[model samples]
Target: MEMVVLENEPEVLMENISNKDNRDTSAAPGLKLYRCVAVSFGLLCILQIALNISLRPPLNHTNCISNSEDMTTNLTEERDELKRKLDDLKSHQNVLKSERDELKRTLNDFAHRSNNGWLYFSHSFYYISPIKKTWHDSRNDCLQREADLVIINSKEEQEFIQRWVKNLMWIGLSKRDGIWKWVDGTRLTQSLWCAGEPNNHKDSGEECGEIRGCGHDHGWNDEKCSNSNFWICEKKMAL
Candidate 1:
């Protein structure tokens, strides 16, 4: 009976082993398929990470380049605008200067026309009166006109004045305290007195100076302040 039981045990064990192998064989394909799917998913994740890494630098570089180009364009546009404004300002300044010059010319023309009988000579304005007056009255009239009696500073000036005078004319020279002086309180340095004149007649004292005749070396004469004569007025030009 023992020999028979042992034999039956071997047969049962063999059958159990064969059943396990059959079950393993049946499940192998499904297990391998699951493993392959997992491995493929891992490989796809790695590839996506690598692709993102590779494209990141180019994208960043492109953005940086675009920003730099935009900044440069903005700066260029601003510079052009500033330059245009500067040009406009310069043009406006030129126009203002031209208008100012035109206004000055108009004023000068008006002055020349309004102030008749005033002639420009040697950087001075001169006026010769057609009527006669005493030396004092003539000086007062010159003062009223913002001028003074002509003060001959040079031989050329004396000659220039003579060309405009037809008769005796009271000048700016006068005898004060027995000393010859100009209207501006300057002592006489040179004189053009006529020969044998300025005797200061005892009866009619000659205290004022006069330009006697034209085209003569000595054309000046001393006369009484009360005497009437045409006079010349002088006004210097503005500096």
Candidate 2:
């Protein structure tokens, strides 16, 4: 319990205060550098967020346009494929129709050959009977054969008949109600009569028309219906 001097105590307190001040001043620069680094990092994060927001809408829009284009291209390709299929189907249908027509013609020709001795000429089938028959009976025979007596419409037809006939043949020409007509009810416009034919003989009444065989000029004549003669039949083709 000895009493200390006041002057020494004062000097010791001042030295301690000066040392604390020096320590505070030395730590201040490090604390300021740390605060500056933290502020720069926060600003960089905000800038990155703004950049992402600005680019997002354009990217989404580009993706939508690309999808739409792809869909349109797919639809166009599908439509073209369908059109090609339709065209192919139509072409095939036409070919089948042509084949069917050709088959029909062949069948008709075969049927004619099988039915009788038929000669094809000018889209018609002709049948010449070997035996002689009366003019009326000859017409009946043609009707039974699904035909009619030959009617010469053209000069080629008349010449062809004359060349093929070996004997007098009954034709479709006849006199009905005093007017010369064909079996089809057509009035006769031209004739290949043998100069003085169709006299309408008063004694025998030559009412039927006939064609004479080859070796004769203008091989046509009028004869009585009761007279016997070879006959010709004609039938049109199916098509």
Candidate 3:
């Protein structure tokens, strides 16, 4: 019985050892599979990181594109503003040039008037004849010179003539049908008659107008058309 027990114990020990070896082999295969899986996971993580790094530049480029667009828009607006300013300056320069040309024309006209034996006053030219003659002869002389007898149209003109004339002078006024009228056929609108004058003092048929001087009233007086007196001639400025 002792021998049989010993043999059985030895067999049991050998069987246990074999079973442990089989378990160890199975565990080894499982560990190898786990290592392969871990390595694959690590490679996937590295790939994802590399992909993220490579894509970042595109996002930055998008921002740069937006910034470039903004700068281009600003430059376009500035260019438009400069163009407008240049147009305005050109307009102002044109106006100034026109004004200068007008002034030059005016100066030229004054010089021409001065050269033509005419004195400029109140936008008109005047000439004091050096000789005395009858009213009709004086009017004829003025016509030959392309002028006419002076016609006083304003108080200022009358006063100016009063100061300018050295003696009595014949004007372009005359009486027709007892009504005073200018040579141009306009009726008299103002009067510079002296007090108590125009009495037709002798019924001598006073028909011509004269600026009375010779140390007298220096006012308007009617006289016979045949009377002799110095005269003033007037002409309009050339356009």
Candidate 4:
């Protein structure tokens, strides 16, 4: 490189440079820059076009748009199914509510019915034909009527029944060989006996129980279940 010192006349130095360089020097540089910009822009556009063609078929517009649409459709179908399940649950709840209301109404009606007192009750009694009965035959008859031996409650209750129970009426109470029990599965604490009754076979062939011969207390006697007598049908009525 050559170095020039500008200590002499500045006008002389300027004049020399002015004559050597062209007056339209700005145009040349501007044109070169424009050409470089155009070449760079053309190369960028060509590269962009080549990249677009190199992409896969699925990256093309149709497949991409269809993929988005399919995703949306699947979401909509799942949402619809969930909504249907929710609706079914609501319907079942309504049905249960209706049934509950119906039950409440029925219960209310029964409550009113009970307030008007028309109740009936029946007690099963062990009965026997005043004639001879082989234990089996008596059991069969009781089964037919859906009833069993009569269980006399209190002493008063026994007397109450004994007055009407003529001849020898079999009581629900009995002794199995030797164990004494009432027909209602209760133990016998009290007994209505004739003076010396239940001497345990003092009477002939007396293996069961019977209510016979009225004492002032309407005592009971263990007798053979044979001998015709009008039986008392023990039942209750609430009015």
- Best candidate (score: TM-score): 2
Once fitted onto the true fold, the runs of candidate 4 whose alpha carbons sit more than 4 angstroms away are 1-137, 155-163, 182-187, 200-203, 226-239
Candidates sorted by lDDT, best first:
1, 2, 3, 4
lDDT of 3 by residue, 1-239 (tens): 35434658878999999999999997998999999999999999999999999877555778899999999999999999999999999999999999899889877866875897777778778888888899989998988877898889988887777767856789998899989998889999888876766767799988898888534558888888898899998876643
TM-score per candidate, in order? 0.53, 0.60, 0.52, 0.40
Cand. 3 TM to true fold: 0.52
lDDT of each: 0.86, 0.86, 0.84, 0.62
Q: Write the per-residue lDDT of candidate 1 for residues 152-222, one digit (tens) a residue.
A: 89998987887788579899989999998988999988888888677797758899999886354538889
- Please tell me which model should have the higher TM-score, number 2 or number 4: 2
Worst 10 residues of 1 by lDDT: 1-10
| lDDT per residue as tens, model 2, 134-163 | 988999999997789998899899877666
Cα distance off (Å), candidate 1, residue 15: 32
Clash list (residue pairs), candidate 3: none
At residue 2, candidate 2 shows an lDDT of 100
What's the TM for model 2?
A: 0.60
Candidate 3 local lDDT, residue 46: 100
- Preferred candidate (TM-score higher): 2 or 3: 2
